[model samples]
Target: MRLDKFLKVSRIIKRRTLAKEVADQGRILINGDQAKASSNVKIGDTLTIRFGQKLVTARVNDLKETTKKEDASELYEIIKEERIEDSHLL
Candidate 1:
């Protein structure tokens, strides 16, 4: 699955366009390397996303074309989530 599509299908970003934009801005990483919107996402791959002040890391668990809202989280397992302190941006 494409990174942008996976993000939306998994309900991580809420929209495909937003996910694409975020990925294009170099705010997403796959396996510790920068990822593009068209990057391939496979099961067991690690993904790190930068959302404003928060950094979220998750491991892809499954891939689905579509999923129910209640089961969206089944797509990935959250490994860590941390906030970026102001000093880190300096």
Candidate 2:
């Protein structure tokens, strides 16, 4: 599955266009490497996403073209989520 589609299907980003825009801005990484919106996402791949001050890392657990809301959370397992502290604020 494409990264953008996977994000939306998994309900991680809420929208495919938003995922694409985030990926294009270099705010997403796959397996520790920067990824594009069209990047291929496979089962077991680790994804790290930056959302403003938060960083979320998840491992892909499943893939589907479409999933119900109840099933979306099963697509990935969150490995870590942390708030990025701005050093400038210190």
In angstroms, give how far residue 85 of model 1 lies from its true place: 1.8
Q: If scored against the real structure, what TM-score would every candidate get? A: 0.93, 0.94
lDDT by residue (tens digit), candidate 2, 1-90: 999999999999999999999999899999999999999999999999988888899999999999999999999999999898872311
**lDDT by residue for model 1 over 1-90, one digit each (tens)?**
999999999999999999999999899999998899999999999999988899999999999999999999999999999899762441
Candidate 2 TM-score to native: 0.94
Residue 5 accuracy (lDDT) in model 1: 98
